[model samples]
Target chain A: GAGVSQSPSNKVTEKGKDVELRCDPISGHTALYWYRQSLGQGLEFLIYFQGNSAPDKSGLPSDRFSAERTGGSVSTLTIQRTQQEDSAVYLCASSFSSHSEEQYFGPGTRLTVT
Target chain B: AQTVTQSQPEMSVQEAETVTLSCTYDTSENNYYLFWYKQPPSRQMILVIRQEAYKQQNATENRFSVNFQKAAKSFSLKISDSQLGDTAMYFCAFMKHNTNDMRFGAGTRLTVKP
Candidate 1:
């Protein structure tokens, strides 16, 4: 089976530019998650989507960060006016459901704001 | 909010030996799940092991196992017969039974030297 996959393995953007990271969850996974991993730090939760329910954005650090899951499968995390602090590995994960035992993570998209 | 702590920033173990990575968490919730994930240099996160809070017995998977101390709010991962491939960043994560997100601790970078 194909694992979760992300595009543009590496992206370098200007401080004020906008960047979008895409995630394709496993074929039938209904629970999707987005997290940020700062250098030498733990992963910080970003957003989550479960089936047809509303996405959870409580973990978004600021209004500049937002995400959307369309057709209950693919998700996109969009960062507007990126900052140097936003330079980190953005990881995407998915599971069978919110209650599933484990999450499958992608290779992660490393974004460097220059 | 629940908080997970991995005090050890880094560790190294000889290949074919045993090594343990410690994790402690603080949470008011009784029913939850704990997980250990391995992230290699490629940035792919893989589930190494998991333990359920209600289960009194610990969980083991092949060369990987967990030491779950419910009362102490501790979950440690032990790798037996460590291999060079086992070198990676180990993360401890916690999630309420049906929560929308899992909180991760600052990862512990483990190096297996031959």
Candidate 2:
């Protein structure tokens, strides 16, 4: 089976520009999550979606970050007015369901705000 | 709020030897899940093992095992007969029951030397 996949492995954009990262979860996976990994830091939780339920956006650092899962499969994380601090690797993961413990992760998209 | 901690930032082990990575989490939830994920330089997060909070016995996969102390809120990963492939950043994560959100700790970089 194909693992989770993300588009635009690397993205470099101006600080004030907006960027959108995409994620394709594994087949049959109903739970998806987004995380940020900064240099010399741990993975920071961003947002999560499960099935048709309302997505959890509490982990989102600021209002500039938003995500949406279309048709309960693919997800897109959009960052508005990106800052230099937003420069980091964006990772996406998926699991069988919200109750499933193990999550498979994608290769991640490295976003560099120049 | 739940928090996961990995006190050791880096560790090194000789090939064919054994090494342990410590992890501790703070959570009030009675039922949850603990996981160990390995992230190589390729930037893919791969699940190594997982332990359910209700389970008394530890979880093991091949040479990878976990010492899960629910009472102490501790989950440690032990790798026996370490191989070069084990050289990567190990992350300890916590997922509360019935939720899609996961909290991760600061990773521990393990270097397997021959």
Candidate 3:
């Protein structure tokens, strides 16, 4: 089966620029999550979505960061006016459901803000 | 808020041998979940094992097993008959029961030498 896939495997952008990372979850997966991994730091939860329910956006760092899942399948994480601190590998994962199911992760999109 | 900790930054194990990785977490929530995820050079995070907080019994996969200590908030992974393919970055994660919020720890880099 095809796994979760992310677009723009590597991206380089200037500071203050906006960037969008896309994620295509597995077929029929109702739960999707986004995380960021900084150098030498742990994976940081960014956002989560389950079906049509309101997303768990508490983990999003600031207003500049936002994510949306359209059609309950593909998702996009947008960072407006990116900063150097926002440089990290953005990982997307999907699970069978939000109820104690294992998550499968994408290869991740490495974002570099210069 | 919950935090997962992986004490060992790096570890080396001989092929076909057994190795154990340590993981500890801090959480005030009584009901949660623990997971071990492996990320290879391709940087695809793969589920290794998972343990439920309410369950006393440890979880096990083919070559992987977990020692879940609820009182101590410890969840360690034991890899038996390690193979060269086992070399990767391992991450420990925690998820609360009511939410899709998942927290991951700084990874442990495992090197399996033949």
Candidate 4:
């Protein structure tokens, strides 16, 4: 079975531009999550969606960061007015459900803001 | 709020030797899950092992095992007979029962030297 997949494996953008990163969770997965990994650091939680309930946006660093999951499967994370500090690897993951402990991760999309 | 901690930033072990990565988390919830994930330069997060809070027995996957001390809020991963392919960043994560929110710790980079 195909694991989670992220599009535009690498993205380079201007500091002030907006960028959208896409994630395709495994088929039938009802839980999706986004995380940011800075160089030489740990994974930072961003946001997550489960079923039809409202997504958990508490981990989002700022208003510039937002995500949306459509049809309970695909998710997109958008960083508006990106800053140099936004440079990092953005990873997406999915589980069988919210109760499932193990999450399958995608080969992240590295975003570089210059 | 809960937080995960990884005390070791970097470590090394000879091939075919054994090494353990320490992880501690602080949480008030009684039910949760602990996980160990490995990420190499390829940037894909792989689930190494997982332990449920309610389980007294440690979780093991072949050469990978965990020392889960629920009372102490500790979850350490032990890799026996380490191989070169085991060289990567190991991340410890926590998720509350039935919740999709997962917290991660600062990773420990393990270098398997021949």
The DockQ figures for the candidates are: 0.81, 0.77, 0.73, 0.79
The alpha-carbon lDDT assigned to residue B68 of candidate 3 equals: 92
lDDT of each residue in B1-114, candidate 1, tens digit only: 899999999999999999999999999999999999999999999999989899999999999989999999999999999999999999999989877669999999999999
lDDT of 3 by residue, A1-114 (tens): 499999999999999999999999999999999999997677888899999999999889999999999999999999999999999999999998997678899999999999
Candidate 4: C-alpha RMSD to true structure equals 1.2
> Per-residue lDDT tens digits of candidate 2, residues B60-93?
9999999999889999999999999999999999
Q: Against the true structure, candidate 4 has what lDDT?
A: 0.94
Tell me each candidate's TM-score: 0.97, 0.96, 0.94, 0.96
lDDT of 1 at A35: 93
lDDT of 2 by residue, A16-98 (tens): 99999999999999999999999867899899899999998988999999999999999999999999999999999998878
Residue lDDT tens for model 3, B26-64: 989999999999998888999998888988989999999
Q: Where is model 3 chain A poorest over a 10-residue stretch in terms of lDDT?
A: A37-46
Question: Which TM-score value belongs to model 4?
Answer: 0.96
In model 3, residue pairs whose N, Cα or C atoms come closer than 3 Å (at least 3 residues apart or on different chains), thus clashing, are none
